[model samples]
Target: MSLRFAEEIILLALDDQSGKLRPLPDRALELAVAGGLLMELAFANRIDTDQKQLTILDRSPTGDTVLDSVLQTLPEGDTSTIRQAISRVAADAPDFKDKILKSLVEKGILNREEHRFFFVLKERRYPMVDDREEKEVISRIRDVVIDGAIPDPKDVVLICLMNACDLSSAVFSDDELEQHSDRINQVARMDFIGQALAKAIAEIQEAILETISYMGM
Candidate 1:
């Protein structure tokens, strides 16, 4: 397999073993192995043996629990040899190793510690709610309302009815509705205005639905 793909598989395998989702170190041997350069090194006396305890030792003994976890995640069979080869190459090829480390860190798959790289599998990801499209959608809705483009009463009512039906079936539970009775009542009071706005929203919604139907949404 290709060195890059092998490196990726090693990371994935380690993560699976360790139950942590962190990037692997940018060892030269790792790059070589990933690039398929390490088979020769593995055969030569230059590399140490592969094993779990040895793998842990190979990584710079820096108390990196996350890194340790990932190393431990590797399967029992190929773990030791791969780990030793990675350690030896990384130790030997500082410049190339550093480059790989930087790439992993920059990609946010690895963290930095005392100039060393650590992996994190469970990286945080923000929800799509903060996307540009969501922002623009909200902005447009506000602009339309503020600009006094009130929708027709029938459309407004239909929109509110749709929301109420959807909420009843898909979102809010009966217990939640009862618990938030005051807020529900306040929202209920806005049904009249919502109905008015719904007319225009309904047209927009219908147009979108029609477009989606044709476009295979």
Candidate 2:
């Protein structure tokens, strides 16, 4: 069972016991999902990106619904500036998190439960049906970020997406994230597409924070 990049990230983001995400602002999770999609395209060689721009290398279907849908949505032109592409994709995918979670649930990797708060507000919780898959994801990330092992290109992409979303502490303990921060950052910078996506995530995060601050003020 080969999980897509987004699926792997979602697995790591969920708590093993509770299946809830670690405390993170909603925008962070949104950006993480967007980043996951971009990384998946990079892994499939469907896209290539540099500091300046993202180029569509292969617009053909990946045969995976989500990836192919995104490929189809790309502009007819071969390239868009990195920020332009990120903004377009992120804007186009307002329900990215929900879509990814739903896919995982359908695959039987996660179980979804609905609940109500005070019998008024409804919410959903996703618990892992099979934790072994999540453990494998953790081991792969640990090998690259903590063990100082050379990572597969896909692992490198995953680490970059995790860091961009501020998910290192969520995936590992606070102490462990701190201990491995340098190595994690080092690995994340190894790919040009990762670098571009990380920067785009940072910019989006900054914009979200600024909006929140202004609203509070």
Candidate 3:
């Protein structure tokens, strides 16, 4: 089976040489993973969303365990806006992130390692055993953003998610990103779901920043 968007985000966040996750701002990776899950559901036709609300179109399992579990829990209604759905999923992000990581390990795409800090603290890091999937994801994005190739909706969503999570630097150098920034923004706006996800991520990030500023005062 293909890797889900959440799985892909985790893979992209891994440092190739260190076999450790890159340092990201608070809640960046988690919210991206959460948005990824919801994005996957949207593409699976199990759910749909518009500017005002997210609706559950079908509750039937996608046969993907993690997604099925999430889908099953989404209350049947268009009551929640897309942002609300993201917040709900992101609340359990650390747990769901683990689930996606383990799934990648089971697929033999990554190897999990443990290190003991001072023989008391345990740190788990994943090193890639196979990078084929990661390469494919990067390639598709580059093609669309750099070569001006028509983007698949999934690729467009990937672009938006990476930018939303501030993971763009992980995928491109500052120069390349600057040069192609327009294309990146263009592709990112192609999908309504991607647009909503980015907007929601921005609002949440802003709220956190505001809270931190208030606390500092």
Candidate 4:
């Protein structure tokens, strides 16, 4: 079984050989991952959202540690809008990225190794233990953007994450991005459950950036 959402976001943001996160606009990755987390929770039927707010549908555990941890923290009642939920989760989840990496390692998708950059700076690296999953993800995106197949809703969500994190360049070449830019934009805005999850994500991403700017991230 695949771990969706944030795990895929981390997978995209990570350095394939080093396991370190790539330099992005600081906090953008976390914010995007938070949006992914909320979407996954919504899909799991543990939460639901509208243009206005997100509400808990079930409090039962999802049996995944990272998901459960964030689920535990979402405020009760319907006061939290999707953007608010995204911001809160992003703010609270300082370790969810590490947890996602550990989950991938446990799944044998990656191998954890210790290395030093300067003979003094020790760091943990996660090289590929299984490259197939990575390839499958890339293939799905290509199928939508390049082949013009109608995207799976999950693929649309992944594209939304990539946009939120400024990660299109990580996966697509300059020419491909240029040529398929319109299709990518169209797919990322696809609808979910009669609401636009892509719009929700894009709105949340902007809200996060505004907060980050005001707070000096």
Look at candidate 3 and tell me the lDDT of residue 108: 94
What is candidate 4's TM-score against the reference? 0.85
CA lDDT for candidate 1: 0.34
Q: Rank the candidates by TM-score, best first.
A: 3, 2, 4, 1
Q: Give the per-residue lDDT digits (tens) of candidate 2, residues 1-217.
A: 7888888888877877877777776477667777778778888899988798889998878888787877776667999887777766677565666788898898889999888888875768898897787888889999888778889988888889888887787568889987888899899999888888889889888888999899999
**Stretches > 4 Å off in candidate 1:** 1-171, 174-190
lDDT of 1 at 90: 33
Better model by TM-score: candidate 1 vs candidate 4? 4
**Estimated TM-score per prediction?**
0.19, 0.90, 0.94, 0.85
State which candidate, 2 or 3, has the greater lDDT: 3
Q: Candidate 3 regions off by >4 Å?
A: 117-121
Model 2 backbone overlap count: 0
Query: For model 3, which pairs clash?
Result: none
Model 2 ranges off by over 4 Å: 92-94, 116-121
Per-residue CA lDDT of candidate 1, range 1-217, in tens?
Answer: 1122222322322222233323422222233322222322222222233222222224332243323333443344433544333344434433443453454445554544432237544343222211233233334323323343454332233224333222222223567546654543333335433332223333434554678788985
Error of 4 at 2 (Å): 1.8
Cα RMSD, each candidate: 25.6, 2.1, 1.5, 3.1
Task: Give the alpha-carbon lDDT of every model.
Answer: 0.34, 0.81, 0.87, 0.77
lDDT of 4 by residue, 1-217 (tens): 6767887877788777666778887677877778778888877889877676678888799987778988987877745777667767888756887788888998999888878777875878888778788778888888889999888888888887786568887789999999999988777667452244445556666765799799985
Candidate achieving higher TM-score, 2 or 3: 3
